[model samples]
Target: MLLLKWSAMGDVVIATALFEDIAQAFPGREIHLNTLPVWEGLFVEDSRFSSVFAVDLRARQGQMQRIVEWLQRVRAGHYDLVIDLQCNDRSRLLLSLLWLVGCHIPYRLGNRRQFPYNIAPAELPKPVHTMTRCRAALEAGGISATTPRPVLSLPQFNHARVDRLMKAHELREGHYAVFMPGCNAKGYLKRWGAARYAALANRFHEDGLVRIVLIGGADEVDECQAIAETCGEWLVNLCGQTEIFDIPLLCQPARLIVANDTGGAHLASVSTTPMLVICGPTDPRRVKPLGDNVVTLQADLPCINCYRKTCSHHSCMSMLTPDRVWQRVQKLVQEAA
Candidate 1:
């Protein structure tokens, strides 16, 4: 069996629930996951997956050549079943190419009713959440995905790395807050302003919730840096220092995690730690982090959930005040306690 979940960190994290579902459905069967190279380390040590295959098909240079080579490898494996959890054009093309190469896998499953997929859900309603769509895809293949939630078990090396970070900062488990205040360049509208985050950090600081940690990828370094500067010594800016695999492990010990509608929030959702995700341009119904421990805050503006990459007014996020978010954060933290 081969499960495909490619690029975009948030979508991959949400699809992890199907990993266990497939593993349970077919006991003793070889289960392999194909994802981007950066995400390969996440499932390397996972017991449910027999192996993790990574290929960067996004690189325009030699992309076709890479696809041909990857297809050859797939054909050689002769996998009995191939599940397209990605359900995108790339995976669809891969499936189509598999047929073109005379590599006929018995079961080709996908979400939408289209070519190359012999099986799919009868009705995958419009504007559905990513997790729900992934679950419905798996269930359509006669697999039960009842327990739909993100789950991650990090390797010892990853845990040790986090231990060193916690010790170096003189931090204890469940005694600190993590703030993810940035998104990628294309999704800048999703950010809830660093100024508002600084104010929220000040609120947390005033309440004696010291040891606020700010984390993000290279794209988010400047945003996190600004927050750290405004909050002073209390904020530990670890932007660009942590790996994708380090997110869940780091969140496991945190008191709470506050993030924009970004991948970090989705990655942190697997942890039991309480989290709050601020949603603006994106629709929470379709993209919010999934878990009982996770909460999403969206402004009550008429233009909320516009799903627009660019906006003239930007009232959805600008109108969502820090004080309003802080109240919900306090309620969540207290409830978790």
Candidate 2:
């Protein structure tokens, strides 16, 4: 079977869970996943798949050429089925190209119907987990999954890098909580206010229970710094310090993770660490972290779960106060202990 799921780190991680369910359901089938180049590292040593095809979607000049080449490669292997986990225009275009190249796959499955496609649509039984949505897609192709949850497995990285980070931040083992206070700058509405995160950090610091380690991309450095300034000396703002791959490692050793609805929250879900995820605009039921240990704090406002790119008012996020988040965090920490 051929599985297609492209970029956006959080979605990619969510797609991986579907792959896990597919692998479990069809142990003998050769599973090949198609994803963007940057996200290939996230699935480096995956034992479930026969191979992973990393496509560079950004290369404009050779776009059709590469598609033709990939089609030829897929046709030669004679895949029995094609699953478009990413039900977007690009995936539809790729599948159309595959058909044009005489690669007649019996079944093609996805979550949505957008293109003038001839594939069977997977119908979900109920409003289930995102991971279950993937499993439902596989079930549409006559595959049955025993496990409904997504599972992620990564390689053992050299601890030297983590040790260096710990030393630089003066972090004692089991004494710090990782705080990812920023989302994609483009989706500013998804981020909780920096001041509120600072207030939460200060509250945690006052209790002497946890030190906050700020984590995010270089673009988020300013916001992280702003929170650090408010929290004073206890906050270790490592916003621009680590690579994408280092995030899971950083979260793996943390006491807890307090993050917005971003890739960090997904990483925290994959780890054994307990996490308190603050949701805004996005529906917690649909997009929250896929784990039992996760606790999501979302505002009760009707405008929440809007899923809109532009909002007239961000009361959905603004209404989720520091105290509300702190209560959830405190509960998670207490339960974890």
Q: Each candidate's TM vs. the true structure?
A: 0.94, 0.86
Scored by Cα lDDT, where does model 1 land? Answer: 0.86
Model 2 bad stretches (over 4 Å): 58-62, 112-122, 125-129, 142-150, 308-313
lDDT of 1 by residue, 87-128 (tens): 889889989999988999999999888889998987766788
List residue ranges in candidate 1 displaced over 4 A.
Answer: none
Tell me the tens digit of each residue's lDDT in model 2 across 1-337: 8888885788787676677777877789888888888888777778888888876766888987777776777787688877887777777777787777677787777765444244544566655656666666566667665442346665556356777888888887678889999988888888888999998888878878557899998668888988988777778888988866567778777888899988877866767688888888887877787767788888888788787888877897788788888888888878988
TM accuracy, model 1: 0.94
lDDT score for residue 58 of model 2 = 62
Residue 307 lDDT, candidate 1, scale 0-100: 79
Which lDDT values do the candidates have, in the order given?
Answer: 0.86, 0.77
Q: In TM-score terms, which candidate is top?
A: 1
